[model samples]
Target: MATIQANDYLIKVDEPWTEFSKFVQSHHYSKIVILVDENTRKYCYNRVKGQLPFDHQIIEIKSGEDQKSISTCEFVWSQLLNNDCDRKSLVINMGGGVIGDLGGFCAASYMRGIDFIQIPTTLLSQVDASVGGKLGVDLKHFKNMVGVFKNPKMVWIQTEFLDSLPANELRSGYAEVVKHCLIADKKQWEEISKYDDLSQINQWTNIVVDSIKIKNKIVGADPFESGLRKILNFGHTLGHALESQLLETENRLLHGEAVAQGMILESMHSVNHGKLSQIEFEEIKSYIELIFGKLEKQRLDINDLIYISKKDKKNFAGAIKISTIDKIGSCIYDFNISPDEIKSLFSQSNFN
Candidate 1:
């Protein structure tokens, strides 16, 4: 079992989880609400149901990036109200990133705020979304356009949940693992950089814990993203824009998939800034393409992506800001890339 002390709470990765039950029982909470999406309800809920010592009700919602919205929040609030949830109640968010984001947003907003814990099931939520307490839903897929920074009481993770993950979902979540290594841990990156058949790997416990350590350390220093924490957005600016633009399309990208492609694109941009060396830039592009596949740059609209990127939450003073790699495991945050530069990059057809 790996544990990290977060800014306000603890992050525990333990199977046969008993801490969750202990906490709820010890607090004698007025009510307990377990929130799940259809997927989690099927694959996760029953597995952990016996752990809760107290009675609780379940709230199930359809799962997807599209469901993380005001309408969903309204539905969650109506359920909380109908079930008589109050300040002393606890909301257990059980599922992947979308469920964690939406459920946390709802619990944080309901009755001003109520206590909640994150029981993230998917690798995406377990490694990236669940730890930071950065809770929110999308604004028309603009990506976390409306959210608040409210830490959960604790976060519990069980690696067994990943067994049910499809190959694509595993690849999607591994993007964050890749991002964490790219930004902070060179040695870790060196270890997993050439991984081809993801199915053969089973040290997920170590990988997940290590990734969380990198993020939690960054978050520990800059919980509000005022400075250091922004580096965690290494491949996210372009990644989020790409995710948003394709939100309604049949070929929609998962958050991590978009970020994987974004890393290759942004790493090339890094070379132009003179921070990332040419050889390293090629390495970034080559490895990312090997794992995530070659990005079909021709399929995207440069103008539309630029428009969506301009709306990125990371911007300040009207500048299109992003985190750029300085080297293999170092990055610079809030680096402003002008619109012309973005247009010019795609126009140059930088991909191989």
Candidate 2:
């Protein structure tokens, strides 16, 4: 088992087929429940279930970003209650970010919190969503508005499972990997830049492990998202707002895509503030654009940007706290900027 120690939490990574049963045996829970989405149920459930101890209950939810809502949590909570799942019962989140987020939220709330494990199957969940232990659901189309900060007992990452992910999802997840490198590890940035394929499991293990270490180190210092943890939101502020705004559109961007665009725009902001050198800012944009492709500039309604920015969780005292880059592997948070400035940045070319 590969273990990452994040302050009080320990994330255990194991081979999903053989090692999961061993984890269960060691814990010796009274009951085991597996949470999955329709897609995971069809593709990954049997492969995982076949390796589990017998007689475990299974709960399934409808798949997609639309399902990561309070209503889904209600359904999951009902299923857990119907199963008589107590605090001692263990819940296994057996899908990507949505499953891990909603399932962890359910486990954390049920009976005032229960033990739950994350079996993150997608690259995005493995590197970003699953390890951080940030759990929440969407509220009225705003992303992750109603959520909690709760760590899981363990997180099992099986790169073998990436085989079933769609190409777009894989690309979306790789964006986080890039973000990880940009925030703290220049060596990792160089390494990931050399690879174009994300399906290589062997190569991915080290990348995932390194990314987890960077996040764990940061989260260890600020587990409750007090100050330093906010750095992890490097590209998320505008990215999330844009992602939320585009969620209902046919050309909806994935989380990583939104974040990729966020990184570019925020890097530009960093340059504008004189925190980052023009060369450094351009380097960041160049690499992201190389991998993510050119940002597709759209005429976003400035009023909508202000509306979403106002609703951002990071907003305090009626001021928006934005994150900007100082240099490679370094970031600063709580930097305030005006809506006109943001609109000016958005109007510029190459900031998709």
Clashing pairs in 1: none
lDDT of 2 at 294: 71
Off by over 4 Å in 2: 14-17, 196-202
- Could you tell me every candidate's TM-score relative to the true structure? 0.93, 0.91
Per-residue lDDT value at 1 in model 1: 82
Per-residue lDDT tens digits for candidate 1, residues 27-114, read 8889899999888998899876776768999999998888999999999999999999988999999999888889999999999999
The lDDT of model 2 is: 0.81
For all predictions, the C-alpha RMSD in Å is: 2.0, 2.3
> What local distance difference test score does each model get?
0.87, 0.81
Candidate 2 structure quality by residue, lDDT tens digits, 1-352: 4778765566666544566677677887878899998888877887766677646899999988789998998999999889988878999999999999889998999889999988888889988876667898889756678888888887888776777889889889988888878878878887887765554345467777888888888877887788987888888888887787777787678999889888888888888888889988877887778777775567456678678878788888988778767888888899887888788888874545
Specify the highest-TM-score model's number.
1
In model 2, which range of ten residues has the least summed lDDT? Answer: 195-204
